[model samples]
Target: MAQAGEQAVGIDFGTSTSLLAVGSGVGPVDIAPLGRTTRSFPSIAGYQQGNLLVGEAAENLPIAQVIRSVKRAITDCSETMEISDEHGTRRVDVDEVIVALLAEIGTRAKAAGRPLDTREQVRLGCPAMWDGAQRQRLLDHAQNAGLPVAHSTLIDEPIAAGVAWVRHRYLQYGEQVEGRLLVFDMGGGTLDIAVLDVVGGPHPEISVLSALGVQLAGDRLDTAIAGEITEELAGQGIRLDGLPEAKTVEALVLREARTAKIQLTTQARHRIVFRGLARTQLPILTYTREQLEECFRPQMDQAIGLVWAALRAAKLTELGGHAPDKLRGMNGDRLAADIDYVLLAGGMSRVPYVERRIGELFPNAMIYDAAGVAADELIVAGLADPVGYDRLNLHRPGFDFVLEYTESGRKITEKIYPAYTPFYSPEEAWTNSYLGFERRGDDFPGPKRGEGVLRVRSTSGDYLALRYDGETKHGLRLQLGWNMLFKIYCDGQILITDGARQTRKLRVHQWPVVRGNGHAELVLQRVDDAPPVPSTAWYLEKEYAPPGL
Candidate 1:
């Protein structure tokens, strides 16, 4: 239970929109209104006359002056955007734009009587495919915006949605209801899927078996539909090529395509009006659900294929095998039968095609969406609830941590920790291995007579090198441990009482893509001819503690 006077705030800083929710003690969470009648703020920012406008104010700005989907740039720290106004044109760092948007959100939430003070518990949701560097960048941005957030408070978006479902079920049944749930979250920029196993009772337990994501969602679908519209215009002798306002016309078409897509979700047909074309008066374009489905078929097929991939990942991990051939005998029937419920989340999940296809894939699973809960608010609702703050076990990292070094003129790679292992379980905390430094023959040609280099690498492409003295006759005993705060540390020591020991902590990085073509290396400074290994404190203070503290 949460302490009295304590508040839990969940901020869903999404690519299309941002939302805020607050919960106190055991009460139901409430979504704070950012405008007179809307609870969401558009995730966009615009520059005008040396001033910045955010949310609804920025939505009306010219496409060239406004930056949409600013959250997607966090993956690349060096990304920049150019925005021009009547005054002049300037280039701005993407991080700066994100910070401004977050600060504005904080201001609006405060004006709505839900200020995010340092004393209140706050959590931010991120895409499941984000690596440690991306996550850290978001945490820093939230801090700069004056939000009460820390590393431990960051929750995966799909997992947060699952938490919302679990809490809603608990309330509906007046008791805990146990089952297996598969959460499908397809938002503006990405599609995240998580398989969760739940045990219901007064104290519910939720474990994420596997999680996966891909950069395919509502935004891509809009682009496809817009392309189809462009073809139609080209056939009508309305060519936009070489036109003065070509970019503007393209943007207008995309905007109309997005609007039409949303309308087609609940309507059979929608009419898109195109006005202000240079010297051309075009006829009103009518788009139907059938045409939309034609444009969506390829993307929808890929999306459903990804769902099967996620389920296969979970099954293979449960079987404790890493080889691809391990799944030769497995089929979809057993996996589909195991899923008791399929929870749809995110704005894209509202599409009727998505629901119908998912229902076909999981024949025996119940497709669930809480009666009154909006798809966009699911993540925030779960984030604000204290019930899942302490009981939800996140999915283990999907990549392995390895040690790479040269031995006898050959490169040797040893796995220190395998993927899909419980990160928080005490039984899997410590991993022990031996680091041999023997120069068996001249062919071995080890590092220098007094120096050696050992590189610790994660499959996701982040690595750190350790330089140590090679004079010790006995090999070093290497111990790697996953700490409670989701960090990995390495301790190397000679087998003697007074032997010198070196300890280094490496932050774990995981992602679906290989970052920078495996060039993301952490360089350590050398001190007195040896690399310095600083010890980090593993304890959390009262204010920095995670939820349920």
Candidate 2:
């Protein structure tokens, strides 16, 4: 049994399936099984007679009473969804549904001989495209679910998957796996692809080169197969009867279709006999592997195209562009020799046809099937960063903090925080933290206002140079309907710029500094004698505005 202290746990809060695992401190990092299968738990939840059901129990419940793919609703900014029961249909908060599912993961963890709620630290994975609000909602749900989280972090799902792949390569081959890797994740609700560069060593580093996602995935294929089955049953004079509404019948067919889809992974054909469905015995729908493959052919092709697009977006492979020193060895559409492996993750990646297609596409590289490692367990295993397994880097920030102002009839703008400032570098032991922006005017000065304070530190570089990033937009935008202030702190000195000075410089001799917002450059003059440094830490002190006294 593991000790009763800080137990590191990682949870992959996926759209179709969710999983939890414990790291080395609690013996080997292993996934906590959900009921019978050591694979994954359905990301489903139901509320019946005031009793919440999650995972397998939720799956066993009637389709009308349970909610599946709640992750999609959450991403759409939906507050609640309607579910029917004996009392009638009622609306339930989306957060509550997510909380119930997460709570189930905690319960199952405890039943597996380990308790997740008592863990020292927990890291949850989320989609890459999720914004601040979406990410916060996930954290709020986790907390409400009563997961004992002394410390918590939300990492990008693809990045976490990359961490797991690197670790697996090291353990299996006893060799450091370096070079670029492409992760094709086709889950129930979303298909996302990410290109990562894994630097092998005692401390492996994973950096995201590019990532792309589409709404079409396993669920979409399931719906397509269901439609085909429906057509086939109609041809046999077997129509769904005695169902309350068409939606219920459609849902029932989809459920059975998903089961058939899973079976097609190994079997050449599947017989989806709809007996007692809709209170009638629908004809047995026979779907051959070829038929199912034909149904999803277009979607499969799109998924393959997405992989190439992601690769091009990462600049690893390109077409019609003059060859540069960076991407030297390249034939059109062919990946670079440096790309060591192509890893297929997520539940849909297990499809035999999909695996075969990916292998044929990347003939030079070894293709890894996620089934061996368990798709849902990959990200959770990445939470073991403290034990030398982690994504050691971050992609460039999408936006740049710029100060723009009108100077002598001409507008001048200066970038304060340039894109890619080494947010969460490999040497750093902790993740990067973003400055908080509140709704109050006093807390963050209006856009017209200039000069604010900021604190910053770096794991590398002597002088933190502020440069222009042509890639990001250059403008100021309010956060949550409130204006923001720029802060740049170097050592104990604060430099406030509001685009007034074309050239600005801050010297701190490599010491950690602060951040601020302004349009003018500040050059502090050395004095023969100055007041002793304030006893209180500058960061702890709040900016004060004196009353008109």
Candidate 3:
């Protein structure tokens, strides 16, 4: 129960897990998962015989009626929300399901000694493509959970992953921003690909150029792999049979198979035994890493293609002007047109094939193995930025920031430079070039022809700097079907684009910002001033634009 006037904490309510951190002590500390000071909490909630079980309790239940993939339901509105209880079945609101899990964890934090009545501001992370509707639902849910959100904001997933990765890299290495940093987060619900240039200083700076994100992540890949495995076994005449439901066996077997696949990262192979599998004799099966890779090789290759596409989107010229800084860090891979450095992070990145494939894909790329920086992801990232819980009290309105967003989905869509995604150092927080827009619910300011789109982003990264990255999955040759989305600055009077034109006015829209899960929508904002800003000293470049903008 945080009291009024208290600074809010940082909560990473991930799809597969829930993590809580306070800006107190030295750096943000992850409240214990099951005990005091724990870092990771299993993302499972269950409704049982007249009781709600969460975390370990729900995880250990026989056959476990716990809800595991609740996040998926949030995005798929047509899907029903139901959970099996010991006595029978129960249907619940999707938001309430999440609230139950949140309350469970919040209670754990309180029990673990986190002082009550001390959180005021809240910073949340969402997918880059999360429509305005999904964001609104999230806000509403947070309120119902009793989490007061003053100075509330949404952080892109890749940017949040960028923050977790950059911080870990700096803490592992030295002080100055290290070489070109690219954080590839293939999480449960979405895949966020970001590249950044970390600047040098006592604190550090991160400049992000682009982040190509989509709803394809580890779980989705797991499902595909499981299907392939089933197909392979079926081809051998080992059919799942005699089960209560044939589909259930495949689904449960697939889930277990994926767990084993992840385990194979360290173990040569993993085997599971499902007493009720279709094939009685082969009810227990074993799988090797090579086997798993073989089943999902095509998808992995597609992932690599996306990575290369991201590099091409960056459009970094080898010219003397701005060679990719061999050592820099930030959100979105804006430092290089071609990835010479691949920084793999997140829980799923443990797959050896991920590292192996990255090396194979980019013959010239350097991959930094941060010892699978997943368990201590955020804590180890606590280094670079010295300001932890102490700065929570200030509540500074102006945090020096450069914003980037897709005006239209195209080659440039992947490279919108944001200030919050990558880990960075301390920097000033005023701006003359900075134009502002309010993202309340679905309301947003739209762009007009000749008026470039300007994305207003909150300053949330540990470091400060700007870099852009991009990728053309559909290819620019198919430009006829592409709607150009430029990431630029709005100095008020004229919109900005780093392209052939820098001055333009975006048309304001009265519609609404996006609120759906897989859709992206933006409403045009009204501009009162002809020329915007009182002028926060511009320390970085005057303008930032995505590749081929």
Most accurate candidate by lDDT: 1
- Of candidates 3 and 1, the better by lDDT: 1
Which candidate should be chosen as best, given TM-score against the real structure? Answer: 1
lDDT (Cα, tens digit) per residue for candidate 3, span 1-549? 222233335566667776665533233334444333346677777766667676767765544256776776655643456655555556756666777776766677677665334333445566554544565666667657766542234445555554554544444454454555566766677766665555533234454444555567677767876776677568778676644545446556667766876788898877766654343444457777778778657767767655653443233222111222321222334424345456675566777877787666555666665522453254223321223212111101122222233455732222233322221111111111222222211122233222332333323222222111222111111111113323222121113333332323333221111212322222233232234433322421233321222
Candidate 3 has an lDDT of 0.47
lDDT of 1 by residue, 38-153 (tens): 89888988877667788888877876577777887873345787656565567777888899889988999999998898677788999887766777789889999888787557
Per-candidate RMSD, Å: 12.6, 12.4, 13.0
Which of the two, 2 or 3, has more TM-score? Answer: 2
lDDT of 2 by residue, 202-257 (tens): 45766666666777788899989988888787777756553455456667798888
Tell me how far the alpha carbon of residue 387 in candidate 2 is from the true structure, in angstroms, after superposition. Answer: 3.3
- Candidate lDDT (C-alpha), each: 0.66, 0.59, 0.47
> What would the TM-score be for candidate 1 when compared with the true structure?
0.73
- TM-score of every model? 0.73, 0.70, 0.62
Where model 3 places Cα greater than 4 Å from the true spot, the runs are 1-9, 22-31, 35-38, 61-64, 75-79, 82-92, 115-122, 150-153, 168-173, 232-238, 245-248, 275-282, 312-341, 363-366, 371-549
